[model samples]
Every structure is written in C-alpha cells, then in structure tokens.
Target: MFKKVLIANRGEIALRVHRACKEMGISTVAIHSTADSNAMHVRMADESVCIGPPPAAQSYLSVPNIIAACEITGAEAIHPGYGFLSENANFVQIVQDHGIAFIGPTAEHIRLMGDKITAKDTMRKLGVPCVPGSDGAVPTLDEARKVAAEIGYPVIVKATAGGGGRGMKLARTEADIEAAFQTARAEAKAAFGNDEVYLEKYLDAPRHIEIQVFGDGRGKAVHLGERDCSLQRRHQKVLEEAPSPVIDAKTRARIGEICADAVARIDYAGAGTIEFLYEKGEFYFIEMNTRLQVEHPVTEAIYDVDLVQEQIRVAAGLPMSFTQRDLVPSGHAIECRINAESLPDFRPSPGRINTYYAPGGLGVRMDSAIYGGYAIPPYYDSLIGKLIVHARNRELALARLRRALSELVVDGVATTTPLFHALLDEPDIQAGRYDIHWLEGFLAREES
Candidate 1:
C-alpha cells in the first residue's frame, strides 16, 4: 500500500479521493491552482501545493507541475480523480517511469480504447456487439455512401478522438450523406486535430447503459453491475441510476459476464467502464472510459463498495478483495449532478455563493467542494457537486432524491436544481422510460 498519494485534480472528485485515502490510513497531498488556494480539498489535505494559475492547462492539466508536486511531497502514487490527466496515456507512462504509481488502468489499454474506431474494432473482435458500419475510417465520400447503403440509412459519423457530442453528425438520407460526412470531418479536425471519422448505424431511442468492471492486472476481473445514464442533455449525462429499471436479471448477468470476460482477456487493471447503447433487447458498444466516472457514486451506493480504495489496492499489485459471487447489488441508487448552471438556458453560473446548505437525511449523500462563501471560478466545468440517494427500491429512491433536492439550498447563483425538480415530475422519468435523447426533447418542449 502507498503511504502517501498526490491528488492531481480538483473539486468534488479530488475531495472524494482524499476521503478514501484517509480512511485507508494513507496521507494525501492536494495540488491546486491559485484560484483554488482556499478550496475545501486543500484545507482537508495533509499537504497542499499551488501548482499554477487558474487556467486548467497551466494548473490541473500541467504534467510537469503535477510531477514536481509529487516529488516534493514524496507521494508514492498519484490519484487523478476522473478528469484532467486521469486517462491520459502519456501522463500514465511518465508517472510510471518516475517510479510513481498511477491509480488507473495500464497505458496500453488507455491508448487502445482512446480512439473510437479502434475501440469498436477491438470490441467487435472480442464478441462484444457493435453497430454495423464502416470497419474503419470512411476515407472517402464514395466509401461512406457504400457503407450507408450496406448498413441502411440514418447512420452517424463520429470523430475517432471526439466526445461530449462534438465532431458528430447524422445522415438520414442519401442526399444528406455528402454534407454530413464533410461537416463531420471538418469538425473532427477542428476539435481533435485529427480528421479521422467513422460511421455507425444510429439507433433512434437507445438507452445509455454502462457496465462497471474491475481488474487486478493479473487476469482476474469482476463486474459490479450497470448504470442507467440515459438522462442526458446535449450528450452529457445529467442524472444516473444503478440497477437500471429496464434490465432484467438474465440480461444483467449475461452483459456483466461479457464485460468481465473482456476485461480479463485484455489483462486490464483497476477501474473501467464499457458503455453500450441498448434498444429492443440488443446492446451495441459505444465507447469505454478507462478511469473513474463522474457518476460512480450511484454504483457505490447500491453495491456498497469504495471504488477509489479498490482502485488503489489494484494499483498496489493486490488482487481484488472480492469474487464475482460476492458482487451483488442490493438496492436502487440515484445521482443528480448539481451543476452551477441556470435552468432552461443552461448558462454557466460561477460566482461567490452567499448561502449554501446541502441536504442530509437517511440515505442521502452529498459530495461537494463548494461552501457558502466559496467563489466558483469560471475556468472549468460547471458541475459543483453530486447529490446521491439510495433505497431498497427504485420508487423509494426517486422519492428520496426528490426530498433531498427540495431540502438542498444554494443561493447567490443559479443551479440545475430546478431542472431536476421538473424532471422528477415528468411521466416518462417517473416511469423510467427515457432514452439518451429523451431529456433533450423534454428540455426543448419546455423552451417552446
């Protein structure tokens, strides 16, 4: 086990890692930017260092600064919670070269799954079902037309290196193919600096379901369960739930085993998630996240496991403490991302918080770094916290989340709390009958 660990990120996730380390009898060093000099995580850490200015590239994303901080504090490992350098292959390689452990998967796996086209090919080869389309990059409009004809229309073009809904386009007819293809290529080049694009048959109303898998790096792996992240806005997940209301025991067991088998086959280590789009009892591979996800709390709440601690143990060359038989979800869990953004418009709301109070009650867990007086900087993501609740069943879980959201208060800045409140009242959301596009359509209806 590592004696001391350095956290190379900020906000709620950084605090989450710190708490995990403390519980494991490990000391933590918090690296922050000048903007976060008075952040909550820094105050709670055993050691704190200011790496650079408020800009993320110069601070949280600066590899040299992170390395310098780890060296100065003598941290044996670096825990990059979620974003920044967490899944960066180069960062992992550099940290490993310096004899410092990275609490994540191997760099080779990261590189392999980082590109969308390569990831799809690999998953297909592993017997993981994928949307039928071009085997590789389209390369030409003529080739894309042929693929469209073979796979049927309504195909989507996606950037190999893109995410967050960027560098993607849909062509529903033959006439739209050329324009869509060219636009996707241009957007891909502008966003990822790589014009490489691929096509896949676009499912109209697929649910975004992802399976969580953990590997010991030695050929052993297990799947915890699935997370229903279909509640999304502009392709970004807004809310997540565990033990998806749609999946049955048989489907769950089959998909979980497939994901675990794939992870073990690749010798993957630590925490990873294999995302899929499910529709009409069919699952199609979407992508893979090689690091901890923002919605991990819901899974933990239902599974009763500390994923961060498990990740650390895996990094230390320890086998997973539990077998597949021991991993069974007991209840329902829901997570609401509390972002510093206004409702309807969804504009960023970053300012000094005059009043802040998080909800607390049975089965309620709030993970946040912002306080009453903290000034939220506009340099990063708008997410300020996550509100998670667990119960014996999905109905009770939804009721708990509603109560918790009502009790929560954050004044002096707009937030997405109102949006969640509205969602809780929707018939589709109440019945768990939503897809990846449902939330967007609902929001659009509200605007109209």
Candidate 2:
C-alpha cells in the first residue's frame, strides 16, 4: 500500500478519493486551483496544495504543476479522478517518469485506448464486435470523403483523439459530407491537436451500454458487469443505470468474458470501461475510456464495490480478491447527472450558490462539491453533482430518484433538475425504452 497519494482533480470525486484513502490508512494530498482554495476536498485531505489559478489549463491540466505538487508533498502515487489529466497518456507517462505511480493503466494501454481509431482496430482484432468504419485515420479530405462513401450515407466523421462529443460531425448526404469534412478536421486539430479523422456507420436508435473491467499487473482481471448509459443529450450521457434492463443473462455473460479477455490481451492495468452501442439487440464496441468513468457510482451501488479503493489497490500491485464467479448485481441503481443548466436547450449555469441541501435516507446517495456560499466558477466542467438511487427494482429506483431530486435544493443558480423531473415522467423512460434521442424528442413534446 502507498504511504501517501495525491488527488489531481477536484469536486466530489476528489472528496470521494479522500474518503477511500482514509479507510485504507493512506494519507492524501489534495491539489486545488486558486478558485477552490477552501473547497471541501482540500479541507478533507491531510495535506493540500494550491496548484495555480482558476483556469484549468494553468491549474489542474498543468503537468509540471501537478508533478511539482507530488514531489513537494512526497506523494508516492497520484490518483486522477476522471477528466482533467485522467485520460491523458502523456500525463501518465510524465508521472511514471518521475518514479511516481500513476494510479491508472500503463502508458501503452492508455495510448492504444485513448485514440478512438486505434481502439476500434484493437476491438476488431480481439473478436469484439465494432461498427463498420475506416481501417485507420484518414489523412486527407479526399481520403475522408472516400471513407465516408465506403461506410455509406448517414456516417459520422469523428476525431481519432476526441471524446465527449467534441470534434464530431454527422453527414447524411454527399453535400453534407463535402461541407463538414474540413471543418471537422480543423476542429479536431484545435481541440485534440490531431487533424486525424475516421468514419463509422452511425446507428440510428442506439443504446450506450458499457462494461466495467479492472486489470492488475499479475495477469488477473474481472468484470463487474455493465451500465446502461443510453439516455444522453448532445451525445453526452445525462442518466445511467446498472445491469441494463435490456441485456439478458446469456448476452451479459458473453460480454463480460469478452471484455475481460480484451483487457488481458492488452496486459492493461487499472480500471477501464469498454463502451458499446447497442441497437436491435446487437452490441458494437464504440470506444474505451481509459480511466474511471463519471457515472461509476451507479455500478458501485449495485455491485457493492468500492471502486476508488480498488483503484488504489490496483496501483499497489494487489491482485483482485474476486473473479467472474463472484460477480453479481444485487439490485437496480440509477444516476442522474445534475448539470448546471436551464431547461429547453440547456446551457451552462455557473455562479454562486446561496442555498444547498441534499436528500438523506436509505437507497439515495449524492456526490457533490458545491454548497451554500460555494462559487461555481465558470472555468471548468458543467457537472454540479450526481444524484444516485438504488432499490430492489428499476421501478422503485425511478420513484426513489424522483423523491431524491425533489428533496435536493440548490438556490441562487439554475439546475437541470426540472428537466430531470420532466424526463422521469416520460413514458419511454418509465418503460426503460428510452434511447439517446428520446430525451430530445420528449422535451420537444413537453414544449408542444
């Protein structure tokens, strides 16, 4: 076990890692920007350091600042809790070069999975199903156009290095492809510093299902099951649940085994997720997130696993105590991402919070860093908190989420709670029949 560790991100996740480390008897070093000088995570960790100013580029994303903080605090390892430097392969290498353990996968694994293009190829070779797409990155506009034609109409041009819906364009016709190709290339270059792009057959009513797997360096790995993240807005997931209501016993077993095998093949270490697009009962591998996912709590609730602690243990070279046979989901768990937004074409809402309250009771969990008098600086991600609920079944879980959302109170700034309430009342969501496009259409119907 590491004597001390550093958390290189902020908000609820930072606090989350703190609690986990405390239980493991490991001290923590919390790094915060100037804006988060007095945040809860900083106060909770045994030691805290101010990295930089409010801007993320100079603070949390600053590689030298993070490494310097680790060196100064004498931290043996660094735990990047999602976003910021979590998925950065170069960042991982930098930490390793300093003889500090990066509580994530090896740099090689990160590189292979971080690039959307290379990941798709690996999935294809590993016998995991993937959508039909270009064999590799298209270097020229002409090459992109040719690949788009090969994949047929209604294909998506995506950055080989992008995630979270950035650097992506949808083209359904020759004219659309002609107009969007260069813009996508330039946007990809700017956002990800890579002009490389690829084409994929876009599935129309796809449900995003992802399997969570953890690998240790000792040639052992296991799957904790899957999560249904199909309910998305603007290609970003808004709601997620565990043991997707759609997957059957046989399919789940097959997917779990295949995902574990894929990770083993790469000799991947640390926790990762293999996301797939499921439409009409067929699963097509989409991409892999090389770090802990944002919606990870839902899986933890159902599986009764402490993923944060597991991440630290993996970093310490401890083999998993359980295997595939020990895998079993107890009940239904659902998560609603409470983004700072206004309803109907929601946009980012960042400001000082005046009143803040979270629900309490069994079966409900709230993960947040904002509180009364907490200022939500506009220099970073829009997520404010995650409202999670667990129950004996999906129906009860939905009802519990409704009550929890209603109980949650935040003043002085708008939130997406209203939209979440409206969504919970939808027939498709009620039936667990919703897809990514369901939220938009439901909102349109509500407005009508």
Candidate 3:
C-alpha cells in the first residue's frame, strides 16, 4: 500500500480518488490550479498544492509542476483520475523516473494504446474484432480511393493520429471520394499535425458499446461488462449506461473475453476501456482509452466495484482477487453528463452558480465539485456533474434517473440539463431502441 498519493487532476474525479485513498489508509495530496483554489477536491484532500495559474497549460496539464508537487510531498504514487495527463505516456514515464508510481497502465501500454491506428491493429492482432480499415495511414488520394473501393463505398476518411470526428469525411461515390479525400487529409493535418488518414466502411446507425477492463500488470485481466455510450454528439459521449440494452448474453460474454485478451496481449495494467462500434448484429473495435473514464461510475454502480481503489491496488502490483466470475451486473445504471453548455449550439456557458442542489437517495449519485456561488471556469471542461442512477430494470432505472434529474437544481447559469429532460422523454430512448445518432436526430426533429 502507498503511504501517500498525489491527485494530478481536479473536480469530482479528484475528490473520488481522494476518498478511495482515505479508505485504503493512504494520505492524499491534491494539486490544483489557481482557478480551482477553492474547489471541493482541494478542501477534501489531506494536503493541497497550487501548481500554477488558471490555465491548464501551466497547471493541470503541466507535467513539471505536477511532478514537482509529488516530489515536495513525498507522495508514493499519482492518480491522474481522468483527462489531462491520464492518457499521457510521457507523464507516466516521468512519474516512474521520479521514483513514484503512476496509478494506471504501464508507460509502454499507455503509449501502445494511445495511437488510434496502432491500437486498432494491436486489438485485431489479439483476435478482437476491428472495423475493417487500412493497416496504416492513407497518405495519398489514390490510396484513399483504393481503400474506399475495397471497403465498398460509404466509407469514412479518418485522421490516423487523433480522432474527435474533426478530420473525418464520408464518401459515398467515386466523385465524392476524391473531393472528400482531399478535405479529410488537409483537415487531419490542420487538426492533429498529421496528414495521415485511413478508410473504414462507415457503419451508420451503430450503438457505441465499450467494455471496461481491469488488469494487474500481468496476464490477469477481467471485464466489468459494457457501457452503452450510444448517446453522443460530435463523437463526444453525453450519456452512458451499463449492461447495454443492445448487447445480449452471448455478445457480452464474447466482448468481455475479447477485451481481456486484447489488454493481456499488450500486457496492459490498471483500468482501461475497449471501445466498439456495434451495428447490424456485428461489433467492430474502434480504439482503446488508456485511462479511467468519466462514465466509469455506471460500471462501478452495477458491478459494485470501486475502480479508483482497483487502480491503486493494481499500481502497487497487487493481484486482483476479483475474476470473471466475480463480475456480475446487479442492476441497470445510467449517467448523464451535466455540462456547462447550451443545446443546438453547444457553446460554453461559464458563470457563477447562484444556487445549486444535487440529488441523493438509494441509487442517485452525483460527482461534482460545484456549489452555490461557485463560478464555472471557462478554462476547463464543460461538465459540471454526472447524475447516475441504478435500479432493477432499465425502465425503473430510467424513472429513477428522471427523478434525480428533476431534483437537480442549479440556478444563475444556463445548462444542458434541459437536454436530458427532453432526452429521457423520448419513446425510443425509454424503449432502448435507438442508435448512436438517435438523440441528436431526436433533437433535430423537435427543432423542426
């Protein structure tokens, strides 16, 4: 067990990790930016350090400042929580170099899974089903056309280095492929500093499902079921749920084995997620997230596992007591990302929260650091909190989710709460019969 741990991120996740360390009888050192000087995570940790000013470049994302804080505190390990340096391989290596452990996957595994193309290839090599695409980058327009032709049109040109749906274009025909290929390549270079691109047969109307995996830096790994991250906008997940309504028993079991095998093949450690695209009774691997996820709470809720604690134990080189048999989804759980933004326009809405209230009960869980008079910072992510709920069935879970959301009240600033309100009311959503683009299209129809 670690004597002390440093949290290298802020907000609810930081607070979550701090709580886990406390339970394990480990001390916590929180590193915060000037903008988060009064954040809840800071107030909760055993000790806090101000790394830099408001901007992330000088604070949260700054490797030197964070490592310096760890050195000063004599913290034995670091829990990145999520975002920021959570997925940065170099940061993990730096922590290891400083004689401190990174409470996640090894630096090698992180680097291997960081690149979208390489990760996909590795997954395929491990016998995990992957979206049929080029093995490497499509550097030329002719190569893009050839790949698209092989994949049989309606293919997507995607940036090889990074993907947020920014440098992607759909080509349905020969003429479309040439023009779209040029644009996707140019945009890929501008967005990711890499003009490399790849082609894949676009699976329209697919449900985005991901398997949450935990491993002990060895060959031992198991999955905590799957999360339906189908509700997305601009390739960003807005709502997620565990025990996906779309995947069945056989499919889920197969996916779990595939994910465990994928990570084990890479000799991955700690917690990670293998994202998949499911369409027309088939699943295709998209990529892997080499860090803890914001939607991890849904898996925790149903599986009855504390992912942060597991991450810490794994970092200490402890063997996992839980196995494939131990992972049993007890109930349905859902998470809605309450972001500081507006609908239809997706603009940032940062202002002082004049009033705030969070829901609580048998199954409602809210992960947040904001309170009354807390100003939503313009320098960070827009997510203010997550409203998670669990129940015996999806219908009951949805009802509970609605009640929790209804009980949530934050005044003085516009929020995307209304979006969830409208989303939960949709029949398709309640019936769990929608695809990834379902919510956005539902919103569009309402606007029309």
- Best candidate (score: TM-score): 1
**Lowest lDDT 10-residue stretch of candidate 2:** 318-327
The lDDT, on a scale of 0 to 1, for candidate 2 is: 0.89
Q: For candidate 3, give the lDDT.
A: 0.88
The lDDT for every candidate, in the order shown, is 0.94, 0.89, 0.88
Compared with the true structure, what per-residue lDDT tens digits does model 1 show for residues 1-448?
9999999999999999999999999999999999999999999999999999999999999999999999999999999998788879999999999999999998999999999989999998888888888889988999999999999989999999988888899999999999999999999999979998899998999999999999998899999899999999889999999999999989999999999999899999999999999999999999999999999998899889999999999999888888999888898999999999987799999999999999999999999999999999999999999999999999999999999999999999999999999999998989999999999899899999
Each prediction's number of clashing residue pairs: 0, 0, 0
Best by lDDT: 1
The C-alpha stretches of model 3 lying farther than 4 A from their native spots are none
Ranking by lDDT: 1, 2, 3
lDDT (C-alpha) at residue 105 in model 2: 91
Clashing pairs in 3: none
